[model samples]
Target: MANADARGRLRRPDGGPLRVLVVDDEPTLAELLTMALRYEGWEVRSAGDGLGAVRAARDFRPDAVVLDMMLPDIDGLEVLRRLRGDEPDVPVLFLTAKDSVEDRITGLTAGGDDYVTKPFSLEEVVARLRGLMRRAARSDTRPDSLLVVGDLVMDEDSHEVRRGGDEITLTATEFELLRFLMRNPRRVLSKAQILDRVWNYDFGGQANVVELYVSYLRKKIDAGRSPMIHTLRGAGYVLRPGD
Candidate 1:
């Protein structure tokens, strides 16, 4: 693949260089993505196959990855699954030609943090990458304070949830889902959107996974109390302040 550095224009919050990995079988597309990332002052690496991408990720240790769905050796979903198994919190953005709902859900469920369809605007790709990077940075700098909504309270640093002065226990996944909802109280979140944001994947195997988890959360957060998690039929779930 052809690689060249564009003039430096982007910088990290620490004023240091950002790093990115571009994994695509198409040489031209990979080069284009590399150029765009470089123009943002990010150190860019390119890999043309799934195996090569994995090796490159290990060697380059990028802060974010832009991966194409179709690759020569291994499928992108498999690649993403492997990557996530090794680094669950690593930010991955998928580039795909397949835009079907199932395709998007599969990509998301396979552990992609975000996805961009083919023939997409480079500006949107950059914006999505920036958002992923910002989110990753925020995850590392969580505040010590508690998040409160009505009678519910969650300790950010401790991963502790409580309601009406009673402690509640939740699985890691449930905690994350609840945290995301509480963070955006009253916002209408469709199941697909919840899967994308909270699960960091699209709804794949079971769209009901969101509903099941919502039930799990309710058992913990509101089993003997008034319901705060509302299910909007044909829509999704929302966390308000009361029953």
Candidate 2:
């Protein structure tokens, strides 16, 4: 279990500083973020526009990105799309002036891991990045990244899920929900628990979301096969071998 130092600087497996890319159209803000990250002993780079951000993402290969929602050439969402086209699971933190629910939802729905509003404290940004790094580390060190239940197989590293020897593609959210079920095979998980673990409490409490995602999972993982996901009436849901 690796821990950050007093300054909250993260280290890679090779003991080098964690690399971060800051993408913001505002030069001063970008420089501020760069300086703050550098103070934390992280290797930081800045891209003042969306195009440059996309270019740098390919060239810099940053561990995490701090991207502004508003960019010059293209919007931050487009930049994120381009980045995800190459790296589906890249960690991103969006900085946005509009803190509306829709905006937040849009960012998260687009695969942004986290978001920070304008006029944010530098410390808060650093903290969020640190949390992302920790999660990334945990994900990398998974003792068994490949999960199998019956004929369904999920490879965490490659983000691939297969059922009955047929490849199944899933959205990021769907993949996460299915992974959670696979990890707890045969154990009944309530909608509340699923929501908390999968979408986080920040998403508010919507039990229907669990049902919806489960339905989505069923279509992909259970259709035309002995269903592995089971509805236990009042007990919630479970994943186990189907007869």
Candidate 3:
């Protein structure tokens, strides 16, 4: 698709402009990136450090993030972890130093969706972001937004989760993980599969996130109630109707 057409299609679900967070210590660069994104009819916000980046992300709920790998308070990887903790599905594009191979590798390995080296072209950054946004659009497409298995129910469009006629709250990551489980009821889903299908990126090889997120889901989804999420030893996890 043409850049303009593709950009037009990548907007908020509410039909508003796409929200983008630009995090860079350099003011001039940040301004330039912001201007470019804004020209594309997006709502743009910029942060100058890791702390500000994290804070802005929470407040803005951006559709995508442009994050620098180095920051005054925290590195980009740590910022990514914090961002993913809350907004699991937000795509991130890293800004690494020119020819910094290690920075590029570490950024992607840490779950950044894409990266552009410093001294890069504005067109390149915008283009890469378009690509990431496109991939995200495809990943997010599903047949049914309402998913049910037993007493647990999720309304994907409304972002509501409830069980046993009671409201249940979950972070962005928790919700997506649960949705993936609910979509494939009674089927074993390995950590590898979860990483590939749900997360779509490895956590610097820290695959334990599968177990960690599962535990989080259990606390919210199954505690003090009939268990629906199950772990088969040496196998994987599955979701089914509770007894």
Q: lDDT ranking from best to worst?
A: 3, 2, 1
Displacement of residue 140 (Cα, Å) in model 1 is 0.7
Better of 1 and 3 by TM-score: 1
Q: Which residue pairs overlap in candidate 2's backbone? A: none
**Stretches > 4 Å off in candidate 2:** 1-9, 143-145, 149-152, 163-166, 170-178, 185-243
1-243 per-residue lDDT for model 3 (tens digits): 112245355676566788899999999999999999999788999999998999999999988999999899999999999999998878888999987877876676567766777788898788767766765665466445778899988987767899988999775556667888998999998888886666555334535657767887898899999899999988889998899
lDDT string, candidate 2, 1-243, tens digits: 234556655786677788899999888998899999999888998999999988999998888899988787998889999999877766788897744555655776666776777888898788778766676665566665799999899998877889888999876567778888999999999887886666544333356557766877798888989989999997789999867
In terms of lDDT, the best-performing candidate is 3
Ten-residue region with minimum lDDT total, candidate 3? 1-10
Q: Judging by TM-score, tell me the better candidate of 2 and 3.
A: 2
Residues 1-243, model 1: lDDT tens digits:
112225433445556677898999989988888898888778999999999988888888778889888888898898887777676667888887845555655676555666777888787788778767765665556779788999999997777888998888654456668888988899888888887776554466436557667766787787878889998898888889885
TM-score of every model versus the real structure: 0.67, 0.67, 0.58
Which lDDT values do the candidates have, in the order given? Answer: 0.76, 0.80, 0.81
User: Lowest summed lDDT over 10 consecutive residues: which window, candidate 2?
Assistant: 200-209
Query: Could you report the Cα RMSD, in angstroms, for every candidate shown?
Result: 7.4, 4.9, 7.9
